[model samples]
Target chain A: MTEPMFRTPLRRVRGLGAARSGTGHFWHQRVTSVAGVLLTVALIVIVISLLGRSHAAAVQILGSPLIAILMLLFIINTAYHMWLGMQEIILDYVHEDKWKFLALMSNTFFVSVVGLASAFAILKLSFGV
Target chain B: MADYEARTSSGARRPRPISPHLQIYRPMLTMVMSIVHRITGSALYFGMLLLAWWLIAAASGPNAYANVEWFMGSLIGQLILFGYTWALLHHMLGGIRHLVWDTLHGFDPADREWMTVATLVGSIGLTVALWVVGYLAMGGPR
Candidate 1:
């Protein structure tokens, strides 16, 4: 009926910390993961459907605001989710502390850069900028 | 100076276990597949940048866009694009597998192995199927 004495308090809280904000990241990752799964399949379908099309036709389809918006969402979520997953991989495998920190920082920066750049591109194409 | 001071202060800091580390543990297919998923995911990050570049260039003008079109048409560029296509498919399948696991299922030893195998085979199959479609649509000429 009683808890084991040897079980440390830290062990109990290893995954359940007081810091709740981290859960937001975890939840968002899962949400985006689901979104990415659907979007990736849709993307493949769209690409295949567009196959054998002329350049102008391809551009016209991609230029639609609806397609632009979906592409924007897909790019941003994919980049962010990839960054989150890569961060975990680096933390798990990179033994050098300094290198791990650098990897984490670089991953964050790279994801943000790619996400922003992709959004910009989509906007440029959609709005003729 | 600040780093030096911090280093001196932290010099006495106990060496912590950085990571349990893959070397310390026996290699498993699941672990290898997990790492591969990450590696491919990272590669797709850059691949998206390529997509962005193409989009932006196409929006710019004929001359500006032609540069990207030319590169993508080149043999070397096609090779890279093929690799990215496979990476994207691999990572996407791996992600779906993780999502299935998160639904409080598929953690059984046999199920886990089957999921891993499925991820691998599915990714390769999807990539090849898409590339075949792409090739056929693009025409027989390389």
Candidate 2:
């Protein structure tokens, strides 16, 4: 669809194009990326601490409230960022409409599965369930 | 330019160029890093599976967690983990570079190339240093 010629000055400033939400993806990708910078460091430290430790040791470390919360935030942010990134890739490479639709659908599904699985794991450990 | 091309009078769309002539051009460091950024980003998608598996195993109790630890301690798994570590670092550095550019600075060609080189080198260096620390934390030389 074509953009309206009489778009408001603010709309022009926002530059949201025909989709009316083009830049939101780009903006949020950046937001998540900044979060990832911090979250990933926390993740690396946690993983390193877990190395050479047994299951019980791992549980003792991860089951802490602060670590669990950080992990949940990491999972959520990473999953959203991943979905955005893969959606862009699929849109670019999967030119056929049907295949593109399938890829996009599976992208969300995959991200959700990974995110939920990880989140569930963290919660299970944290709650001792 | 491709999108700007008009359709034929009969309304048939024509093929269009999609990117800079990548095949014909000499590879620049920035160009290489641009591609690497995408590659590392994609690699992280698969790496996330490893993470999910680890978490799920940990949650499932000792036996399941032991299986995961066995695999992760194997040579192949270590190699995979090493590659994943490098990819994560490279992608994170690349994202920082992009963030810098979004501020509308660092567009100087020389500065761009320098940042790209730094990203490549820094990712490798950080990955190695992190692993060293990790090994030491594990009591070393195992």
Error of 1 at A63 (Å): 1.0
Compared to the true structure, candidate 2 yields what TM-score? 0.89
Q: Candidate 1 on B34-133: residue-level lDDT in tens?
A: 8798789778866877877876766666666677768977999889988988898888788888888888899999999999999889888987888888
Instruction: Give the range where candidate 1 chain B is weakest over 10 consecutive residues by summed lDDT.
Output: B1-10
> Which of the numbered candidates is closest to the native, going by highest TM-score?
2
What tens-digit string does per-residue lDDT give for candidate 2 at B1-142? 1264657789888665567667989988898899889889999986999999999999999999999989988999999999999999999999999999999999998999889889999999999999999899889986
Each candidate's B-chain TM-score, in sequence, is 0.82, 0.86
| Weakest ten-residue segment in model 2 chain A by summed lDDT | A7-16
Per-candidate alpha-carbon RMSD to the true structure: 6.0, 4.4
Residue A118 deviation, candidate 1, in Å? 1.5
List DockQ, one per candidate, in order.
0.38, 0.57
Q: What's the true lDDT of residue B130 in model 2?
A: 96
Superposed Cα deviation of residue B47, candidate 2 (Å): 0.8
What are the TM-scores, per candidate, against the unseen true structure?
Answer: 0.78, 0.89
Candidate 1 docking band:
acceptable
